[model samples]
Target chain A: MAGLEDLYREIILDHYRSPRNRGELPTPPAQRVEGFNPLCGDEVVLFVDLHDGTVADIKVSGQGCSISQSSGSMMTAAVKGKSVAEARALIRRFKGLMSIHEQALGGEADQLDEDGADGAGADDPDVKLGDLEALQGVVKFPVRIKCATLSWNTLTQALDEAPA
Target chain B: MTAVEAGRKAATPLDVARVQADFPILARRVHGQRLVYLDSAASSQKPRAVLDAMARFYETSNANIHRGTYQLAVESTEAYEAARRAVARFVGAPDPRGLVFTKNVTEAINLVAASWGGANLKAGDAVVLTEVEHHANLVPWLMLKDKLGIELRFVPMGEDYTLDLTHLDRLLDGAKLMAFTAMSNVLGTLTPIRRITDAAHAAGALVLVDGAQLVPHVPTDIAALDVDFFGFTGHKMCGPTGIGAMWARPELLEAMPPFLGGGEMIRDVRLDGFTTAEVPTKFEAGTMPFAEAVGLHAAVEYLGALGMDAVREHEVSLTAYALRALKERHGDDITIYGPSEPAMRGGALSFTYKGIHPHDVSQVLDQKGICVRAGHHCAKPLLRRLGVGATTRASFYVYNDESDVDALVEGLSDADDLFSL
Candidate 1:
């Protein structure tokens, strides 16, 4: 019953309504990458500027459902100042959080608590997920896990494509 | 006789109560509410008859077809071929021999693209297609064009949402094939088949009709329509998944190469060169989905017994009612796509509610046990043409009634309130 509430969290809706880093950056120093979820027609064009082996500016532009659009918005905010390696590390952390939450929720409980209930490895005392952890509940809605991770995957690809 | 007794004696054509009885899923609840299933355009719910038919086949005649000499295998082969014949007659094919069983409509169209398209379409050859085609029809042709140098000319959409036939002659001119959908699954626009077929013929181009949306809703006669190849899936018409059919002209079937190379499609086994089996068998590669085919046969019988005309009649009335009910309640807040007239379309209705995104609307509806499809609906190009990211579509079937429409309207109202607030 609370699954929809968990999915469409107030923070998620706010990001969806008024997204951050919502436009493209020029292509000279920026590498542009596109991610598409053909099933739902969701797409993200992520622009990243990597200078001197560090991430300078990140911008996201696209149209999609709340889950995808909001995740893209949060992703830009979380990774804007981090180095390319740090951004990749955050991607791993977020994906690990989603996987852990998925295992905890099981099939019957399609909703996760605002904070990880079983603490889902959060008790490690070293995992500080920041704003990106808001997406941990996305694992409850299994179909939309792709939506929550689309931009991060695209960012990974963008980094891989860019030269060292 | 009493009024109620007299009314009961006449007997409705659909006997919806009886129809509902045939689908076991209809009896189930969703989200603690009555399951008002309206997502048939995505795929139809199977009737008990189809399910039983498949189960009975597995129980009685469980063997590989076309290879074994045992009695069970012969029975399996007959059942498979009988389903083919049933599908052929259901679509009013001039001859059942041209029927080729495919996995689904997408596979059927792909078979044509690889087999027929690859053979005939050389460099500089042109193919005409409409803008409203499902990705299943458009993407394969694009892939073919990428492999072979060919041109794809599109028929533009009119402001009224139907195909603008004014420039159709120009599009078809010099085109080797005019491939289009008989009905738009997104907009519910029933494209004029006979007119398009005639124009394509006059332009000296063969006609290929994607009947995935049309055959399930209307009475189809391939001979009368003068189409070269007609493609459709079984699941959209109360049949099971994993089975579909393509009715192509006998000559075209004979002329094209085998699409998939496998054990069943070849006549002689030689590593250097193999001779292909004839027509339908040639196209049917590997062991067929005979159980699903048996289920599809039962579905065809179910529809045939109800009469396609009656099915169309029931759907039109229901669609018209739903349209009026939705518009009447919402007024200008609702924007419905495709043709406004029910006669000019099928039961599928695509629309946006209260300027809320279709995904949001569908999510809200899902909470209420009202099933509807949202997103590009496998017709992304069409949605882009319409200047929308996605649409929420509620399609009607034989078992759907006025109450289902009411539930849909109620669900939309809930969605509007949830978003607007």
Candidate 2:
């Protein structure tokens, strides 16, 4: 029951009201990606610019529930000015926070990407999700877990599509 | 009972506590809170009678009909046919043979589109539908338009969410069929079925009344509405799923070709040719839904015992209560999406709170064991026309009382408190 109280904190609502990096980056260099959750009609579009294998800038625009839209704001703020690898690391941590099991939901949970790396959970002692941990309560509301992760998942796709 | 509970019991006309007792699920909880179900517009919770009827059928007489000569088979066949007659009578259609059982309302609509539209419609023919139709009613006709080159005209909607029929005469001109829902599932707007039926008939077109939302809540008479087709499903009416019916005139059914072809739907079959069975059987195809039909029959009896007039009267008062409570409590923060008057709507209430997304509202409501529908509700075009992306709908039913509406109000207030700046 205490977990339910933490699910919608004042910070999350503040971000939902005044979102950070809440627009698209202007230029051809930015890689754009769109993600939609047809279940609730939540949509998020992410724009990113990769400079020297790092995220030079990021912006997001979309309409959705408080959780998803606020998550978009937090995600843009979390990964901006970080290395592309660091952004990927943040995504991995974010998903781990939102994941139901210790392993990822799909059968390929154990399969590491080309980096030959460990499938580490976001609770890693060295790397923390920081303020994004506020969203850890999302796992409590199974139906709304997708709303909190739509932006991060869409941002991951934007990273993949970004130019090296 | 709690004080709030006693207050609601006094406010509501029906004995909602007794009604709730008939549904075992109402005693259960969602998210560790007492369940407050408000999605009956989607489907009603089954009463014990419907459940017992189904269990009794499966326990005693679960057998294929029309073929097996054993006692169980004979009993099953009798029960199935009796269910059809019960359903037909419940809707005030005189002849049971005039009813064709389909899997659900979507299938029933598709059956009409495929069978009647296939046979009667040509490239030049047109079908008139409303802007507020559910996908079940809209998609089949759109598919028909794709298959054949028929023109599909739509009746636009007013700001209040009812159909704007200023040019309905022109829209119905040269139309072979006029299909519409008796009630709008999204906005809870009750369409003027009698007026629309008269207009469609005057325009020389047949009509289909999608009663999926209307039939369960009100006393419907196909003869009084004077529509050619009455489509509805059983699941939403407190019966089991997998059974629905379309009531049409016997002569009209005789004229339309069979929708699905299978063993039960044929009088005789050969490699060379086959003869289709009579009206209902010709449309049913394969083995019918025997047990679900029994449950639906029990549902008819349950509703009849409650008296459809009283059932409707209770909801009318409940809707009025909800509308006033939500408005008086939240004011501009809450925006209901249907007619301001309770007379012009069913129990389904689609609305939004400030700018908080409906999904979030539904999620919060679910925490309080308040179940609601959030999204376009399979009526994307209507939602788009309403200038909103999605809405949270808290619909009422026979089991709902003033407490349920109070629960909804409390939940919405919670939504605003948690999400507001």
Q: Pick the candidate with the highest lDDT.
A: 2
Between which residue pairs do clashes occur in model 2? none
Q: What DockQ, on C-alphas, does every prediction get? A: 0.44, 0.51
Error of 2 at B258 (Å): 2.9
Q: What TM-score goes with each of the models?
A: 0.90, 0.90
Q: Model 2, A91-149: lDDT tens per residue? A: 77777776653234442244233212246645466666778888887776666777887
TM-score of 2: 0.90
- Model 1 misplaced regions, further than 4 Å: A49-56, A83-85, A100-124, B1-12
Q: Candidate 1: how large is its RMSD?
A: 5.3
The fraction of reference interface contacts (C-alpha pairs within 8 A across chains A and B) present in each candidate is 0.46, 0.64
What TM-score does model 1 achieve against the real structure? Answer: 0.90
Evaluated against the true structure, the overall lDDT of model 2 is 0.87
TM-score of chain A of each: 0.82, 0.85
- Model 1: per-residue Cα lDDT over B1-421, one tens digit each: 9984465345456777888898999989887888899999999998889999999999999999999999999999999999988999999999998999999999999989998999999988999999999999999999989999899999988999999999999998899999999999999999999999999999999999999998888888898899999999999999999989989998899999899998899999876999999888999889889999999999999998887877888898899999899999999989999888998999999998776778778878888888999889999899999998888999999889999999988888887665673
lDDT per residue for candidate 2 within B1-421, as digits (tens), equals: 9994455455435677899999999989777889999999999999999999999889999999888999999999999999988899999997888998888999999999999999999897999999999999999999988999899999999987899989999999989999999999988999999999899999999999899999999888887788899999999999999999999888989999888888799999999999998888888889989899999999999998887777888999999999999999999998889998998899999999988899888878888999999988999889888888889999999999999999999988888877777
